[model samples]
Target: MPVNYTEDAFNGLIIDTNTIPTDSVEFGASLTNILAYSAENNKGITWLTLPIEKSHHVGRATALGFIYHCCQAHELTLVHKNQPAQFVPFIPSHTVGAGALIKNSAGEILVVQEYGMTGYKLPGGHVEQGERIEDAVLREVLEETGIKCEFVSVLGFSNKHPYKFGKSNLYFICELRPLHNHIQILDTQEILDARWISLADFQRDAKNSAYNHELFSALFNLSGLQPQALENNKGAHKKLEIFFANHKDGLL
Candidate 1:
């Protein structure tokens, strides 16, 4: 009886081809000859068969080579296929999040420590469906910190690590001013603690926590703090520079 190849079987055969040594010319020639013979015998394959496979492999190799070259040229750490990239789209999940940087009269920045999360982050939360990002930020801030805020300017954006929460993108850096008189913080399930700290204090806590270093750095740069302060704080400034640099390339 003739060998029968199902779709899955054919796919497995193709995968098996990957293990073939690239340096073996005889192996390549033998595989090519066998594929040609199989196509001729099967009569199901057409003129496009060999060309299509060749094209696909060539294109894939070319793409991979280009990526490798770019990473080498830029001195970037190359991620393998199995090692997922940061901020990549995961399974479909609805996640609309936003954050704000609020400065008080005493030059303190507003930050909140969530009950479950490890780090102290800025006040923000998921943007509900049919809600604008600005509105979401406003609502989240009020709900978390018990302070109404007026939107000022946009700082930047960031994305969550891939393979987590369906690869959500978190919109960070919307400047805001307080509006309410009584700073009566409402203790909610989402937030455990809230407080305004000096920029230095915020930086210290952020460094200690597993917070997004790049995002915080971008926030500091956008704040336009004193040059002396920024220079004195090398870690903060370095993080900011890296964030801004990544942000620029992402835009392009």
Candidate 2:
């Protein structure tokens, strides 16, 4: 079953330490209140959206470190809203990734075996800084598997649930038009293998599949995608119109 989570799921405790004026006493007090609230309320997670002042003189980093330490001590879940991508120096952190659903001429889906991952997964990876979502999808695909592809419409997104993903990861789900027939694993150190796999084969080996089976199941069913129709790549080259439905229809 999909984890039914939403923003409202939490008794949102927005800990904004930025409002504290440039006073040492005030800063210390704010920090104390944050830790106390979290320690007292063993439930709600803390969403930190503090100011970005890393200067040693300003002591913003030190304040941020205290927030971090408090969460660690209380075993409280933390959401670094100020630093969604961690592209900046240091505020808190969140990762953004892009992935593609690439189907081949045989209609088989493309999957890659990662060095640390089990079974197989869609050919995609972390989006580089300043990279567009579509570009990131194509770039990651080519980097992992030397297979060029054309951009198709996106198939919504799978927001990484903190419980499953550990941190907040907004992953884009894109439909890609493959240009090459052969897949060449370029990054041998990071990638184990890349190849086409049939839906039947994927389903049959679900027992031995990766830990992301629930995610794939949610992807296909939520997107209203038909695996049975595109199971075989026996026809001429044609553009596939991917069907999409909001995966967060009910969960979000």
Candidate 3:
């Protein structure tokens, strides 16, 4: 009997594919239907994740050929993930991280470059258990930059998908004002160098790579600091222009 499938239900189709006998004819038909219906109906599933069933030597590689065919024949963008690179006996869930967005009196943004990494990053680290997000941000900033700073306001956080190590990270960005203006590495164990960069320079570096581009964009969006912080907010970085008739701080 040909398997019946719901119009747009994943469990009704994909999930059932796993339990079906791989040696049986139903397996091929089910997988074919999944690819065909996904291509035609725009099911919008990017990852065609099939269970790692070792019973019949079923692997993601087996599906790759069909996925390639789906792209060539039906013009679909699909990939598969199963039997991870290295099977971890056990792994943890998403991690919570906190970073600070601080500017110097000269309006330079603070960034840190790790030992083995290219380009600079905001001062941040994983939030330990029982630590408040605000506290974590302050601790990480001080540890990485060795600059004591006072928290101004809660900026926001970035939620990243699992890219490497099967671990996603939630990074909280907070507005901080430096109490002490000095760059000393308190945590040499983690960070190699720390420096303050001009906002313009930071923006260019962020947009340089796809990873940094998305990261910085997410940071600005999460912070909601300024309307001009979005991805389209390009062009030469301009100085602040406070327009007021009477209220003049005389500081740009």
Q: Which ranges of candidate 3 are over 4 A from the true structure?
A: 1-92, 163-168, 204-252
Q: Residue by residue across 1-252, what tens digits does model 3's lDDT show? A: 443444322211233333545454566666565556656654433233333442342443265432321222222222432222311112246767777878888878788887767778788877776566667788889889889997655566678988333568777677788997799999885687899877567677643456665555555433233212244445687432211222245332
In model 3, what lDDT does residue 192 have? 77
User: What are the root-mean-square deviations of the candidates from the true structure over C-alphas?
Assistant: 17.2, 14.5, 16.2
Please provide the root mean square deviation of candidate 2 (C-alpha atoms, Å).
14.5
Residues 92-157 of candidate 1 have per-residue lDDT tens digits of: 344557788888877777788876566677888666665666677888888889899886556766
- Candidate 1 regions off by >4 Å? 1-94, 161-167, 180-182, 206-214, 221-252
Q: TM-scores, in order shown?
A: 0.47, 0.50, 0.47
- Give the winner by TM-score: 2
Model 1 residue 119 distance off true place after TM-score fit, in angstroms: 3.5
Clashing pairs in 1: none
lDDT of 2: 0.59
Better of 1 and 3 by lDDT: 3
- Candidate 3 backbone collisions, by pair: none
Choose the strongest candidate by lDDT.
Answer: 2
Report how far residue 42 has shifted in candidate 2, in Å: 42
lDDT at residue 221 of model 1 (Cα atoms): 42
